[model samples]
Target chain A: MARPVHSFVCEIGRVCSKAELKASEQPSALWVGVKAQKLPDLCLACLQAGGVFDSAFTYPSSISSHWAAVYVFCVPKLSKPVVLFSHAKQFHSVSAQIPAAVWDERKMREISGADFIGLNDLRPIIIHPESAKFVTNPLRGAHAPGRRPSARERSAGHEEPAGHGSEYGFAGTGEEGEFQIPVGPVHAGIIEPGHFRFHVGGEPIHKLEVRLSFLHRGIEDFACGRPMDGVLPLIEQVSADESVANGVAYAQAVESLASIEVPRKAESLRLILLELERIYSHLADLGGMAMDVGYYASSSRFATLRENMMRLNGRVGGSRFLRGLVVVGGMARDMPEDSLRQIRTSLRLFSDSLAKTEDLTLSSSTFIDRAFSTGRVSPEVARRLSLVGPVARASGVPCDARKHFAYGAYRSNAVRESLGQGGDVFSRFMVKLGEVKESVRLIEHQLAQDIDGPVLSERRDLSKLPSGRMALGWTEAPRGSCMFLVRSANKGALGRLAIRTASWRNWIGIQEAVRGNITADFPLINKSFNLSYAGADL
Target chain B: MHEFDALLSPKTDRIYADSPDPAIRELALFLKSRPLSPFSRSIAVRMVDCGSSNDVELEEGLTNAPQVDCERFGIHFVASPRHADVLIASGPVSVNMKLALEKTYRAMSRPKAVVAAGDGACTGGLLAGAHGVYKSGRVEEVIPVDVKVAGNPPAPYELVLGMLKAGQILSKKRI
Candidate 1:
């Protein structure tokens, strides 16, 4: 199903011309398409293409149709972009192609009445067996399901299928002694809930399957009738860390579809906010990587740095994580002169501290020992899976949405991506750290060049938006290039909003990276990827 | 090392030098007054996570997920709902996690205290009443919450607040 064949000119990557590699996408071999019946073929193409089998989710409401399965792909470059899309109706499943899609398909099928015709694993993903009657896709609004639930059925995420599979086996090649250790739908950590089953022999895991959906908040359905502007706050709720990214994506989608343009100053200010986000996010991950390696000093020091960044966030954007600052056309309020000065001061502070922190972490033998060789992802694998951001750069895949797809003020600047070769945890850490420095550089550059004028653009009233157009907006967010597709309805309100994050595409590749690694190293490895549960679940 | 340690040891750990917050000192004294258990494990409850903001990490220790010193002080994090006598719920309780939270609570044999951790879980700090939320802002909206550890994200000590409150409730029940 994977499509191939695309030739591009150097310098600027404009698709010179495209030949279909297989079927259905501009870059054919890169993204494969299949009819619902060709689910197994889809899986074979993905496995054959050597990309990571990322995730499968159901929109529950598909463009006025009550249900649909939105299967996502994170393949490397053949022709298609990193994310692949396919639409399927209710009672039909596509898990036959990719084994990891099983749990997601089961949940989608149970809740939204979708199907997985050839699914080997179809146990209820989350909802209890007794709660199976509800056909409630809380995330989507008014999109009528093929069937409705009985009075006994309750709403929300709980809608487990009755009497399902009693046993499931890991697809292992050899090893008679290999066994599976199931971790959680509920775990000991202060994090999101996911069911992790690790098939292992001794310490090495042969196979791993992650069953996620513990954080699905039914956001899509909730935002259905809400005004176009009303969606930003709700989108921010979908993932807290990605407030800037998601907000920008939503705004971009709205702007593109509506054809709205803002002042130059607002654009640069938006870039500043975006860079602040990247720094804090990368710092958190760096600290996490240190913590995973048992480097308490490095971890604590980095945490202090991260905390300072958060404080800077509060000072600049009003809220700590830059929430409420982002609106549809432009930002809510312009940055106070004092706030800009404060930001400049903090940038210097961050730069000074980062250098010292780097010395501490880099010089620490233990920290390097822990991160240097853990969870090594190869370049070929990175391309196949279509991994993004630091993960892709680590494997020498130089595809950064920031540099590739120019948006905000970034179209004018020199944005250099921090890349690595080994694709290990250290590489991921280096990329994130280097990106943080680059963010500082961005903030400094923007500050040096004054941005004067109104933050918001002069546009039609949000309530009175124009109709019948679609726009795609993206920003190089903290995690990666977050994309948003916004389609307008009859009125100014958005008819359809498809939001995808780096975490969603990267998570599957993480499961692949875990192959052959020790179970104990999973935490360090997972930290390196640092994918978002809220982003993926959405 | 000895000289610096000795210099800091006497006045440094003499109750006042241990913490910056008076609340922490108060809590320390409270702990000192109790019969402390003794035991420790090499592996703490270490976790690598993908969801939520870094609020969880903020509420816990930065070095490890959270070195709760549970077994070291009559405290223990349960492996199973049956094993866990306490239910520590985090975040604003999105609709997806509500069932898992409820199921985890139900599976515990008996005598469970649900500690709502993080600002979002406690009072839905910022993202309240929005689309992504399950219902109301708090986790209690989805389940019966016993204690709330509130902050933008409750500091580790603040996290201890809920568990300690639960401990108080547990001891009272036992008595």
Candidate 2:
């Protein structure tokens, strides 16, 4: 382990014991293994000493009867990241210290059926209580053939005895002059569904509660027992807009476990695809903010630019959403010189149009007034919630995975972390705009480098991969940092897979950001964060 | 300003189309030759995402982008199901969202058509038999679907064409 990680473990060891803490090192990060009961104390001590909680996940352990809980934390000024893990039948929760851990622990409990004691919010994060009875925990031994119930049976189980609104209950503020407003599991727009409950006094929101997991498709369970190669397609679909990032993250996990080095050419190509994905994803959020603020012209212009980029994605990778392009070892297919030329040409056009759209949007007083000073998340609150991506960056936290934990081509290429001061809607908007421009520069830089060597690694047989190995993979998704934990079973099948997307961590920040803002400003604020329901739910 | 001017007259050559498919070509020729039928010319669509990764929704949004411009052909996405002539549902219908899908379909007036807009909705695609997903993950299992647009997520023009086909079905049902 690195000195910083060793010292941090020593610090945690003082609270627990040196014998209780086990340290191991991975290529990208550090791993410190601890006993389950000591997790709460260790996490609290780490957070108190300025350690940022990156992600926490749980998986069934092959060696033990108990499940293993992994919590990744990054201590500032430390060059290497640290992942502290512990094994237990049930783990103590750290949600009281880090609010983001609430959702992580809830999801851990739901999937593994592991108890999380002292969890402030015990409400089901992914599975509805009504459907929970019928649907078997896919991670458990109940995953037998022919176990899937018929649609008729499933719907019958979900039928409420008339007058019962929903299975999950929303917490109310219980204060005078506060009325609850419930938004959709089915919204008005062409977006995925998740319910949002707001306790409001007139137009100002007092407390907001978000109920997601409406789009949960059991992705983690579906990936289990499948061969390493077959899981890429499933990972790509984890969040459509972030297909490349998720795919890269999953691939990196597999590569790290297998100790396969991605060729330099493939690394550069992967970086290009990742930056392109960032460009299109950021464009959507930028345009959505405009649409929420009624700046239709700028929004349309952004939409046009996004479409052109998606088209370019299709032309280069054979899918508009860049699906089927990233495989386990390296890339699924190589980018031809013709495609590179085309992408470069399109990028020039895209940059000019983006500048114009940014000018048009910023020039509008109505858009400016609505966006500025709205949905402000203070730096303290952002750090407490452990928010990532543009949302955290906008709040003045320099938490870019590319810059901090440089992996793949990022290890060589320079990455500039875009920062924002206000953490308001306008700040988020500017951050995204700045990121899009930065992504364009990154793509150009990658393209300027020599594109040579084999795109796909030589190791083609995934079934022959060694088993009983565990590794962590992470990439800077357009939304934020997307991390994947992979454990290979004895038969080269996925023993356990846990994914913690950026949206899953950042969704809690929205609950705090929306407070004290008017109900009408909710849409603008929500669009600024643009958290993913499917990603979070999965 | 120059970019805005160029966007006003975006070239149609880049728009996605199945020109190689004789049936679609014949249908296009037929629609072009005839006086535009009310259903064929103008239609409002309401999209519901039951349990998708949201790729379908992205493509659906892009259908209205200046390049595709399905609105020029009188296709618009309305907020309410009551105002829609076609309901385009995406994703494999999850158990949590199955009732919502049924309600949205029921809310549309009679003589309406439904388009299953992605492989997930049409046949459950990758998440066909997962534990969290509804059985088979097909939209038709929960509601009547008039058109099945198949892709991991179908391209923007493909989604538009699928809705147009559903509009054709709505016109036929009226007759």
Candidate 3:
């Protein structure tokens, strides 16, 4: 389904629904309110409307102000799209309406000392259980005995968590039919480390609980007041494969805060690299999925093709994953014509090889047998958890942040989304494959195009003191849309910056997908969904 | 012919015409530059899993999985680190894992080499200064390292290259 011409009509509809909520004149900013009472009611209406729930975070809107829990919303058809919720200013907890908002709410309450009532399962998702309790952001006049918060605080914080004061222990009755098989926070693969506790009877899995945070870099706390340029390298580490996407999201957030515009050429170059990044990332997942399902010929071919593309990328971009290529306001360098032509040729070869891989995979009966019904995520669950990207698309939820949100010249159609039906492993596979083709097509169209402009934008001179400010930037990364909220206290660099990658939001979907699946099919199911450990751990 | 044109001869076929793989071609050239050894039987290397980092553990687990029919790939992971030809370690050299790494290295026969498999192992790149992590964040700091495979966690292909590099190092070592 496509947006009807003159889609401003939907904007009008949103304004009518939330009369108190107003649309700002800024490029794309939506303003809404809690009406002092109906926080739950407003959240419920927003959740049911099928909007992409971006992230939930806490910022003291004003430096001296108490912590305000914020929920970021990406409403595709709304005039005033961004919706925020805070339990401190309004309710205790804002997660009653959103199932995926649990981790964010718990994290907010832990650090800022906010309270979130009515939130379910508020565990310390990032900090270790035994860490001591020191302020997460000592920059807000809070103090860390050391330069960084001590582990004593973080360890105890993990056990109690910010929001969850009470959590029940998990133990099952000893019976002949049940046995527990624990598989790591340190997994066996290229996969990110996250502990999985499974209750199984014979070969069938009855229950599974995931424990992540093995690679926690404390990106949010560490990012406070770091120079803008210094931030990209840190942001890029969120997910190695989706670095550019995180770069774009962070850069855009800072640009919007300062009201700076990225030059057209810079924008075009950004899209080109973003699409290239999308292709390689998806190829890794596609090949991994095929191999997971026992189609080695198809999987190995995919790997061979993937390696070739990565080498080609390293030649053109300097770094294979396109790191150090992006900066605030624009790209670090321009794409030469020879490199563009080489990329075009590389794409064609990749497309051709992809066909052979597809044929081999499609013909292999054993491959299809494992993937078809394995890790089937119900359409209802997709909606309930607000699934995104292929996970959302496969489950018959047609949401693409790039297409709908329209940022970074992606609206030009150089890159379109690969979508899928209600959430299943096959749906995720089809969505990734669709995206690969779009990436090739997008890069091809941009080959001869020229943008008349500068590559870099001027920076903000933050020497003067004033009231702290808040700004948000997001990009539709290959994994899904990643959002960043940067808030600078007049005293220094932004006191608090929250970076939420798509992996954090989609982790619950993985748990849901494995519910009915057999224990033997875990790897196949995990590969298909392919959520990130580093991204989620942050 | 121009230098660039001369570079095209090795990958003259139109098959991969878009761009030639200089890496593979260079790898081939590097091999060709050396004289062939009478040692037809390649080194049999075994990766050890001492409950180390994710990628190392995964590659270690993959040792028993049916090997891809690709040749010149004789890397096996031994159940006991004592039987391992190569102690492929990945970690920030954690205190708990330190004894294990040393035990595994000591267990390996002489002329054995150690390949540190990821940035965490090579430089303790990310996990520096953490409570659980040791003060110094390098595998070499704890143990004498032969080859370092650097990456957040090196990709599987890179891991293969690092091991092969260790194999080359192993060939030169005197028993």
- Interface RMSD (Å), each candidate? 7.2, 2.5, 8.5
lDDT of 1 by residue, A269-377 (tens): 8888888888887887898888878887777667767666765686677776788888878888888889999888767756777788799889988887878878989
Q: In order, how many clashes per candidate?
A: 33, 0, 33
DockQ values of all predictions: 0.19, 0.57, 0.13
Per-prediction TM-score, please?
0.75, 0.93, 0.79
Candidate topping lDDT: 2
- What's model 2's lDDT at B101? 84
What docking tier does model 1 reach? incorrect
Query: TM-score for model 1?
Result: 0.75
Query: Mind giving the per-residue lDDT tens digits that candidate 2 earns over A1-538?
Result: 5676677667766778678878787775677788888888888877766678988887766555477788988765565556888888678888877787888877776555556777766566666765555354443453221132346644755222222234576767788978999888778888889989999999999999998888888888788889887888899878999999999999999988887878888899999999999999999999999999988888888888888788789878888888898888888888889999988888887887778888888999999999999999999999989999999999999999899878899989889999999999999999999999999999999999877999888975667777767888889999999888888976679987889899998999999999999999998999999988999887
**Best model number under TM-score:** 2
Candidate 1 local lDDT, B35-131, one digit each (tens): 4322111111222222245456444533222222233334544456666556677766665556666777777755556777777777765555534
TM-scores for chain B, in order?
0.70, 0.84, 0.70
Tell me the lDDT of candidate 2.
Answer: 0.83
Error of 1 at A376 (Å): 1.3
- Give the Cα error of residue A251 in candidate 3, in Å: 0.9
